[model samples]
Target: MFRYYFLVIYTVYMLLKHIKLLYELQTLDPRLSYAKQMEAVYDKPKSFMRGCIGLTGSTVSIHQFGKTPKGPVLYVHPKLKLADLAVLLGHLDKTPSFFAEPRAFRYPLVHQWLNKMGAIKKNGGEHTAVEQIEEIVRKGQSFILSEADGIDYESLSSRLGVPIVPIETSGIEDMQKGSFFKRLKPADLDLTIHRAYLPENKRLRA
Candidate 1:
């Protein structure tokens, strides 16, 4: 009986130690901790920009949603490409009035790609999929793509009190075709979510 008890205690201690190690590792790396990142960005006025919005579609541009400056914001869509980044940069240059999330001028991917061309260490960290996402949203940024409608944008917006500028995108297969004009589409105009915390006074406009 004593032997069994000792073994059980040992097992429990080992499990707890493992869990503690994981928690410590996660806490040590800000890139691995989305909640920490979100808390860091929330309420930081210096990062916020008024009336500025981000735009992107689906897999390729999903990273855009995680980019935020600090203030009244929204996102526009239809999947974008390298050229779209250039165009957006031009727009930012032309209109100091607006700040766009995931500023095309400072794209992480562009930096990574350039580094790759030069044989430098370029891939971003290997964070878990959910952590990567949570880091993005909690940081007061929004994304245009979701596996389902309800999970990401709505939940994050409700938690952060940030309005989501949701936009739909064609699936990955349709997006690979390289035609510029063919890719842009007017987003689906009528989508709604019935949430308890959403401000009861304001109606989502078309």
Candidate 2:
């Protein structure tokens, strides 16, 4: 009886694994599409104005600031209009978005597929700018904006095998001169909402 039960459980586990992989494969196109759209929005090849957006102090307000040689100058005010924010985030319903550490994807098969499709590249050039940022801080001088001018953030993220947010965090840590980070709690909410809900059998394993 014990041997029969063990065999049945093993079979079910394998079945669930393959099923999950298949479902991920089906969603590949939408994921790729969203990635492309984000690239289009954030990175304008011909736009010469270099800027970054961040929260201003503890206030609820935020600032879109131009990166300058001396310091960041406020370029835009308060908040984005509802319509503009919606246009920026319109792709959220089509697919899930979150920050994943470099080379640490929850779905290995999906990561492999993305690489095969040329959605991201893992060349040695990855993190070159990140390392440069660290070195600039070591010399006790400001790393001016011009140092990073003309670099495409979307392309850099692709090469680094992660999202742009991680790059932001990397620069932040270097500026603060230490690391203060913890892994965020993982949940199945994105999977469920995106209609790629995991099989019950694989939940615990995942």
**For each candidate, what TM-score against the reference?**
0.28, 0.20
Q: Pick the candidate with the highest TM-score.
A: 1
Off by over 4 Å in 2: 1-110, 124-206
Error of 1 at 151 (Å): 6.8
Candidate 2 lands at a TM-score of 0.20
lDDT of 1 by residue, 91-135 (tens): 221111111233332543333222211111212232333344344
TM-score of predicted structure 1: 0.28
Over 4 Å off in model 1, which ranges?
1-76, 85-109, 112-130, 140-151, 166-202
Error of 1 at 100 (Å): 16
- The RMSD (Cα, Å) of candidate 2 is 19.8
Model 2 C-alpha lDDT per residue in residues 1-84, reported as the tens digit of each score: 332344346434543555544445444455454334333322321121111111101101122122122211111112223212
Compared with the true structure, all predictions reach lDDT values of 0.32, 0.26
